[model samples]
Target: MKLKLIAPYLTLIFAFLIISCSSDSSNETPVDPKAANNKSLGTAARDFLSAEAFTGLHVEIAYVNGFKPSATTINNLRNFFSARLNKPDGITITETVVPATTVGSLSREEYVKIEKDNRTVFNAGDELAVWIFFADQNSESDEGNSRILGTAYLNTSCIIFEKTLKDFSNRIGGANLTLLESITTQHEFGHLFGLVNLGTAMVTPHEDEQPDDAGVDKLNKHCNQEDCLMYFQTVGNAVGGVMNSLPTFDEFCLADLQANGGK
Candidate 1:
């Protein structure tokens, strides 16, 4: 999803309706409820990492019919969150089947419509909710052989191009489907946790430099360590751009998370 296997790196952006739920004294302007569940990416890092604000984590995994992620992947995701998050209350996941998109590829608007219509979980009480959709098609952001696997958009929302991911996983020399799913899921989840200097500031300067679509240098919001899960390896070079095995967060990432209140 990071780079097109051909030449250009497609940038996929999703703009969700923003709502600030925090209420100030009766003196400040009113907050918009319509913006509920939507916040800037990486803004909810502390809430997910630390138990200070949210003591429990609820993940809503909604998928297109017949495209539900494997149980192994789900367990892997749960384990990843449980290992890193300080949510002592508990971490839970709920899966639901949603209608499939009619399109072969999905645009930002299509993504928004689907999520708005089906997503049922949002941050409530002492629990922080995370929403993830498993789409049955490729992202409209795809170009050439570069197919998007997943994208983390709003603070608590992400979508996985499940069909495309499966296709790639079944490819010759591709990584195991479960491993690919687990890694990709964890990677997107890492974004939600604000990895590699995203929302959580880095203890050291380790953000990797990647070129934009125009070949311009930019902080592509990934880790510098190739062995880290957040590293942005070019899919064009790797077979199907999927990892052969699961990867752990590099020490720098661990430091960032710990500094931000994560275990």
Candidate 2:
């Protein structure tokens, strides 16, 4: 009878060990496929930007009529990007400028139509294309004053805008046109990089709390830090200051880029 009792206890102990092992195996953490893919893509993008010597990325610029940016302005823009993007090794920037033509004043709808047409020629690939229109852009609702400076289509890797830099130069006396142009370009590109609360994940809370007229609940798609290039307040206004001093990507902005596969 004692032996029989001991045998049943041993069987129970063996069954308990088997169940424990099964539970442990089932609880092992599973790998996330989406996260793995995103990480891989981010790594690849960084590698492409950091290459020692290669074709690198291409930026095609098209200007309309008398709004062509000067050589000095172009060089300044290139230098700015080279320092931030290439770092030590330095990457190549291939710029192709299209000559001016007669593109008169355009409304918001007309501008979008033109942009859509340009997309066919520019072809959304690895290259970045920018179209600079000479005419002013007026809001669809308010057609009195020129509002928008620059706009970037993240999906197409394209930027479209008018000569708002010149407008700012006129409004804000003693402002450098070239520098303003450079800042405008930088700000638009910042949007493409997913600054503030855009596609790129923010390392810190730099998003502005101010609500735009559109009645959007969340923060504006700009940095809260007034000095950041991504700040919306700096775009068209000359009250605080002018774009003679080009804006830069602040620490918080840089941190977001670093996290999102940028140099």
Candidate that would win on lDDT: 1
Question: What tens-digit string does per-residue lDDT give for candidate 1 at 1-263?
Answer: 23222322224542221100111112212113435467777788999899999999999999988888899989889889888999999998988788877876887667767878777777788989888888898888775545566777777877877887677667555557777677767887888898767789999999887665589877767788877877775222233443466788989989999999998
Clashing pairs in 2: none
Tens-place lDDT digits, model 2, residues 15-113:
110000000011112112212211211123333333333224445555555666767767876776575554343333434344432355444445445
Model 1 root-mean-square deviation: 8.1
**How many backbone clashes does every candidate have?**
1, 0
Task: List clashing residue pairs in candidate 1.
Answer: 19-35
Off by over 4 Å in 1: 1-36, 234-243
Regions of candidate 2 where Cα sits further than 4 Å from its true position: 1-55, 86-104, 107-109, 112-142, 156-160, 171-174, 214-217, 236-243
The CA lDDT of each predicted structure is 0.72, 0.46
